[model samples]
Target: MTAYESLGAAVRFSNVSVHYPESATPALTDVNLEIDEGELVLVIGRTGSGKSTLLGTINGHVPHFTGGRLSGRVEVMGRDIATHRPRDLADVVGVVGQDPLAGFVTDTVEEELAYGMEQLALPPATMRKRVEETLDLLGIADLRAAPLRDLSGGQQQRVAIGSVLTTHPRLLVLDEPTSALDPTGAEEVLATLTRLVHDLGVTVVIAEHRLERVVQYADRLVEVADGRVRHGSPAEILADSAIAPPIIELGRYAGWSPLPVTIRDARRAAAPLRRELAGAFPTVAEVAPPPDAPASPAPGVTARGLRVDHGRVRAVADVDLAVAAGSVTALMGRNGAGKSSLLWALHGTGARTSGRVHLADGTDPASLKPPQRRSRVGLVPQSATDLLYLDSVGAECDQADQESGQPPGTCSALLADLAPGIPHQRHPRDLSEGQKLALVLAVQLTARPEVVLLDEPTRGLDYPAKDRLAATLRRLARDGHTVVVSTHDVEFVAIVADEVIVMAEGEIVAHGPSADVIASSPAFAPQVAKVLAPVRLLTVDQVRAALPRNAI
Candidate 1:
């Protein structure tokens, strides 16, 4: 018999508290949570709020792998984590971390998927069958031979998930599994996971910031904040949650008791609100420059015949586009639609088979050196940690200040503004995913570049941090700094993007105002837009602004 087959609960935490070395506060404190067999539980919280720490304890990574002190009991499948290390529970518990690239052990997609099964001593035929099943399940069958390093961030995330799913563990712990996926891809993965829960009786626990996508599949919700956890049904926790998805926010704004967690629920509850807003048309005007600002601030970025080739694959193909000055532009598409390749080519870092990219001064970014290119166009890639190598957050900020020729602590101030409460002495790699992204963003902005590019910037950020980032991007536009963001977050686009550019198969398929484009497209539409259809309203803030003071 298997080691944990006799256990009643899939996971159990008994008054668990964790303290990391040299840290003033515990990562998790007085936390008591339990997950039963065949349950799909979602863990929700802000960035750096101990959601990851709680997930780590499931497989004994907390005090064992993380070198922290544990005061209470953590058991996975009734196996005591104090005695069972991560490897000891590997057969029954599988984990996919926030950064998929970091966890990869093989070079190719097929190899990675088979590696875990090999470790379990599964027969070759079984491994082959499971590998093919997982690849097709995650829709990465065509990328089976593709190198893990060359695949898009979303593709890597799928491969990572597939790698774990191939193991067929009784319990699965996923951290931001769908954070890198497009809307459709996310839907596919979540549907597959829900099937696993219903059909196979697998227990799944997920921690995600994009709750709009996964909340519908949750059997229960666990809220983690300040090292504390609150567990209940989705409606029970989100009814009064300060950090909520746009759909939940809309439900709460309409004062719907038992707030909706799904699009259908919100839409059903929004009929009256839709009637109230029937006559109102929401429009997002470009942020106007200050009166004292220069009349012709600067020319925005323009590219003609841009093409990026990766081996035999043509990632970006002859894309021609122009970004207007003092405007926030959002580039969006499916997993391998060349958004990252296009952004890198624009930033003068990625390969360009043939293209002409010109900045404000009619200068080609590709023609400039590294430092000059950074000053002209700054980029925060999908792997935000690639830019961080310093020992501590303070050290990284100081280096950015020195390299960018900015005054000391300039980057530090920006970091504080972007994500507050990040300890200066903490190592860059040790910080949470959102915290790392914030630090890299601060470093890039220290150069005061004319144009900024961010790829999936909201992957790890909570709603509050996204609000801060949106405000920062809007401020950049108002200051005549062109900002371009490649993301799958439709809600964020509705809030920050003045113009939306949709790419498909490496070509721009649709380009228009955010409301015009997203409202018309079913796949890209935000939750509020989906709920309050026929009104052209894209955000809860827009709905609130259009209504009377007490109407909401």
Candidate 2:
């Protein structure tokens, strides 16, 4: 029998504290926690709040892989992490990082899934059986022969999870596992994870920003804030926590005795609020153009007969759309539904088989050079770090200012505006996923481009950070800049998007205002919309505005 079988808990931490080099603050401080076997723990925190640091301690990556000072004891599967390296704990621990591509070891989906089993020297018959089972479990069987690089971001995330599952480890540690997936795809992965914990008795720990998607499935909630950790049941912790999902926020706003964490509970409790809001129509704040804009503004972007092909697959097909000059449009769809491809084609990057894309001035964006393209339209791709090559954040900001011909510290100022308090000297790779995205966003906005396109922009941001980003996009629209965001965050879309465009099978399936499209569709509806159905409320803020002063 293994050490974990003798011990009661799957993982234990006793007065754990981690300190990195050249950092005055400890990443984790005096953390005392224990995770029982077969428990599914959800970790929530703001951007750069050290959620990842706590997970790193599980598999000995804290001090073993990353050079740092680790104090106190961290035991995983009853083995002290201080003595065991990451590879030493491989049999009991399987980890998937925030960036899935970084962990991939092979070229194709099938090979990547079997790579871990091969490393463990499992028998050929067992490996083959496990590989097929994992592929089917994760809903990636059709992609067995597909190359890793060609798959969409969400597809890559599934393969990453499947790769570690084939090892049959006792503990699974995942960072933002559903960040890149669409709503349906996220459900499939989460359902599979829930099954693993219940049926196979796997211990799962996940750190995610989109709490609405994972909070309902959590057996316990762990909140990491400023190097401290707090743990309890999902309802118990979220009741008093500062960061909460839309569902919890709605429950609190409606004065429910106990805050609900799922749509069904909230819906059962929302009847009174819906009655109060009867006949009240939701009002969206209008964004007026800046004073410098022309009296009759041209369309921000216009496309016709756009198509993007990849080998035998048609990623985007004969799409036609127009975005207003001062508006925020959300491009939303399931994974591999052509959202990212359309954004790339619009920005004059990626492969475009045939299309006509024109800017406000009726200029073809694809005709411009790289530098010229930046001035007209800027793009922050799904992999935000791919845009950063410099060593330090300060150096990157300086370069962006120089290239954009903006004043020195221009990019730094934007960075502070988006995500404040990021260290200037820190390496881009060393920063959390959310921090890297902010840095890239600041760099791209330095040029003051006419049109901005961001793909999966909310992958690692917290609730407050998302609020700030929403305010920023609203400000951009008010200033006569065009903004387009392709994301799977339905709540975020409800907040920021003036227009919603749904794509499927490389075509525009639904096009209309945010409320009409999102509220009607069960798959894309936010928690508030789902809870207060028929009333058409999309966010907590909207619900607040519609209620009477005394009711609040």
Each model's TM-score? 0.96, 0.97
Model 1 has an lDDT value of 0.89
- Candidate 2 pairs with clashing backbones: none
What are the lDDT scores of the predictions, listed in order?
Answer: 0.89, 0.90
Candidate 2 regions off by >4 Å? 1-3, 279-298
Candidate 2's TM-score reads 0.97
lDDT of 2 by residue, 120-184 (tens): 99999999999999998998999999999999999999999999999999999999999999999
Best by lDDT: 2
Window of ten residues with lowest summed lDDT in model 1: 284-293
TM-score of candidate 1 against the unseen true structure: 0.96
